[model samples]
Target: MKQFWIVGLGLLPLVAGCSLFETNPVPPSPALTGVSAQDAAWKDQIKRVRGAEEARFEPLVEAREAVSAALAQQGVNDYDAASLEEAQQALDAAESGWAEVANKRRPNGDKLAAIATDAHRATRLAEIARYAAVREINLEKLVAVNDQLETREQSQPTRQARPVTGDARDLVGQKVVPDQLGEVSFQPGTARMKPASQEIVRQLAGLLERYPSVGVAVFGHTDNVGPSAASLERFVKANPKLEQQAPSQAEKVRAFNLALSAARARTVAQLLVDNGVPARRIGARGFGDTRPVASNDTQAGRQANRRIEAVIVPGPDSPEAQRARAENAGS
Candidate 1:
């Protein structure tokens, strides 16, 4: 027993020495410790993204953020792998554009334009993946509902073909609104629809077609950025009767944002109309930056704030529908 204790005590110093040696291994040579090209490129990208955000390069920052948000979404990769892959490809293209621009320290206007175009494409593709994922999730819920109905029908004969009334109707309506609408990006400072936004419009149209009774209230919102003079002039021209009550620059900016948001909402509504959704069942409005789902302090939050959301109204009795009716009557 004494020998065993002595041996254990002797081994303690050996274990301590091994740990010390492991923790203090000789540092690699400077050449060997250098980052690989790939690693350096990745670091450059990180810096670029941060710099873009700081410089308020909306297109590049938004593209980077959108792709990241889409990829991070739950089940996005699994449910919409094709769109997700396309998004990645577009992002890669954007990254390549950045790298090309980096080589030309003073990129010309054309090269800068090309980079912006690539970034916009990346943002659109990422939005497509995100919207597709949301649609897939909604479709799965609908399929589950169908399965539940089938099970009930098999258990009882009378409950079959009951027209999806009551709770089921509410469930479908609730699930139909793509909650990720806040991530649906648009062209910078324009009502023009991105390719991915078109997908969202088509999906909304299909839902309206499938459930004729379901009405949608489309609401547009904007970030806190004040409108340009040209935009404010356009707004004032279009909304002569709804002119600003106060002449404060802030108030005018608010009015401009409201009008711009409304125009964007109308653009989406027009797309729905073209897609065969009845105009009567659709009510479009704008809240400007009033109802932000996220902070407007950061680029990511601002992107989220600048969005168009669609609220599904199940029936005439719904408060949303009633409010729409009231607004129309007043107008």
Candidate 2:
């Protein structure tokens, strides 16, 4: 017993030293860390959808409640079934995905992103189901009443193959408003579209085609990883290739970053045009490293900064950007 105690006592300092040397050995799951902003946004969107509805359907309402509870760290957990009857199952899936990440079993990012999308869709379904379920009478009478209306609706002119000129306002409104839009990005120091970005651009092209009046503006930015001026002489030396001695390295770096951003924006704009969106309805710009929505110190943050910010522009008549649109209509 004394020998055992002595051995254990001797190992205590070793264990303590090992722990002291370990620094951030196990970081937080990238999936959960990256999606904090997206989760908050989805929560708000879900609330708005529920608020806008005339009434709430039972299944959808239950699902919404379950999702709310799940997100609150209640209801279903990693250990339970944790199923929501409706769209927010994706939310639970997202949580479970993080657990999987912690165990080093799976990558949760793609799955969570997909689920976040479904949760958004679920909100719409919840809203639509509520209105469709309401009846002035019992189920039998309601079914009889809707049968004829359903047939009439079938015969009505479909919105499919709608020409770009079709009621511009309605067309604009009909465009698929993606859940959490405008988060597309590219590879480091390259204008090449990440695979997901290509798909998003494709979707945006279809949107512009459907709504000719709805203009799109894209801006590109860069992570702050290049030359910075702390002193005047060093600044001039940084841009060694420039013949003009007065031009600081910071100025040269800014110009390079801006150009890189512009190239990316132009690439996206050209893709939109090629995909059938009119060139006159899209504008692309680059702000370089001047604007950053996230820190540039981490990989995720840097990727977020190195992005193309695509905005849905208001109508030509809207007070916002009316002059800018007129002057720079995708030129």
The candidate maximizing lDDT is 1
TM-score of 1: 0.42
lDDT of 2 by residue, 1-331 (tens): 2232222222111111111112222222223344666454333323223454332223234446544543443222331232324435443543443344333222344543554444444444333233222111112232232234335545778734333344444333222322234456666656777888778889888766665445655667898765334433453455566536555566666766886787788788788767877554555666789877578889899777777765444433333334443443454
Pairs of colliding residues, candidate 2: none
RMSD of each: 26.3, 28.1
* Per-model TM against the reference: 0.42, 0.38
Model 1 off-target regions past 4 Å? 1-168, 171-183, 233-246, 315-331
| Number of clashes recorded per candidate | 0, 0
lDDT tens per residue, model 1, 212-317: 7555556688988876788776766676665645456677777777877878888887888789875555655667877665788999998878887665543333
Clashes of 1: 0
